[model samples]
Target: MDSQADLADILAGEPERIATGFQFTEGPVWHSDGYLLFSDIPANRIVKWTPDGKTETFREPSGNSNGLTYDRAGRLIACEHGNRRVSRTEPDGTITVLAERYNEKRLNSPNDVVVKSDGSIYFTDPPYGVSEAERELDFQGVYRIAPDGTLTLLIDDFDRPNGLAFSPDEKSLYIDDTAHRHVRAFDVLEDGTLANGRILVDMAIDAQGSPDGMKVDTAGNLYVTGAGGTWVVSPSGEHLGTIVTAELPANCAFGDSDNKTLYITARTSVYRVRLKIEGMKTF
Candidate 1:
């Protein structure tokens, strides 16, 4: 996926603006219900947009949510920045708090999340959502929530960890540090712990944007929000180029019936483009 032809093949057509008039937007997730759900952070709402151009509020006062994804059971798991916790929306429409504190200390802020096949949840906690005086934890950390509700701290050395994703085979985890402007890959052990951490990509010091949200395709190509636009890179960290958008994109996800549409959550609006490649299936 390093060649220009490969990049061109994934871009099906010009990116079209599907919705606008939002304050800061992030966390775009594709649902099987024929709609794309995203977070309007400043508005404190989650908005749903359909392919036919219909947009509506899915949830209001959304805890100032920033990142979202569906678990294997098709439940919506969200990273609530305002509430400083990770939550899951149940089938009965009730919200369940998954993780809020560790070692009796409140989390700084839950920023992004991803679930593993074994029913384990992984997320990044940074201090972006809260002020220094209001924070309880002294360091930013990456954590995992087990199926039995046990919370474990994976890594706590990051300056500001933001986005995270698993490899196509689920044998590796990739997490990006916003303050450092680099992405790191970690080996996923049998017990769901991370090890053998290494730098996968460095978004040059002079780059246009810092590292934020990210996703991977079925072929293992990483699409990360950084610098100027969405940076498309190979699994080994080769810079393939970027998918430019009108506004500075905050996050993105694969959507549509075939999972071939890349939905982007930019500063003020949500945009999308059809792609020839299919996104990695979580289920």
Candidate 2:
């Protein structure tokens, strides 16, 4: 990561492994209550990590949860791969099914999710958790669940929509297609539908890994986990640098009180690295 030094203001220190021994880690979200939660996909669980370097099971048999985020109200919104639905974990610990089917057809697999400032929820549906015969939606899609309980298909042509995030101003939605090995930016229109879809960055130049999970900084820079590491791309779509990790990281989140710590969920371990920039939090 020679280019990393060019953006040294972003990376404060090298990534350090915090915890290990998980099946397949993904979906890292920082809670305001001082903890980091992430999914161990094949293990069917969600793990919580603390600043003390302790690990605990936040949820077992999590329906194979993938991506996770907190709504403005601080409630957990999750994409469940095994359950084929998007669920919300309420403050009282009761689970609410936000989105499970569209047009009376079951979803393929909700791979990742994000919450809008308007209380709306968005998620990507791909068939990574199930077989072809088990999938109901013929095409992978990016969907939005309105606060009124309406499910709307935002984009349906993605080859394999894996991860997604909204810009700081909520003006743009960035989604990555793992199959296509590229990230696409979409205009978040007034009606919550998308428009002006365009490729933001292509990762084909790096032959190591495909795009999976993504996050953005306050400066509008995108921290996408792919192409052999975490690609730090400028808002204008320039690949500025990379945070190459020992293990192939699947997802990342900004945690700690100041939101200056980046937590990465690699293959079998959780890693953390300091950052000079304050990352955008869930709320």
Query: What are the Cα lDDT values of the candidates?
Result: 0.90, 0.92
Clashing pairs in 2: none
Return the lDDT, model 2, position 280: 93
Per-residue lDDT over 1-283 for candidate 1, one digit per residue giving the tens place of the 0 to 100 score: 2223446856888777889999999998888888888999889999988878999999998999999999999999999999999999999999999999989999998999999988999999999999999999999999999999899999999989999999999999999999889999999999899999999999855656888999999989898988878888889988887888889888999987788888889999988888889997655
Candidate with maximal lDDT? 2
Model 2 lDDT, full chain set? 0.92
What are the TM-scores, per candidate, against the unseen true structure?
Answer: 0.96, 0.98
Q: Which stretches of candidate 1 lie over 4 Å from their true place?
A: 1-6
Candidate 2: deviation at residue 59, Å? 0.8
Query: Cα deviation in Å at residue 139, candidate 2?
Result: 0.6
Backbone clashes, candidate 2 = 0
lDDT of 2 at 224: 89
Per-candidate Cα RMSD to the true structure, in Å, reads: 1.7, 1.0
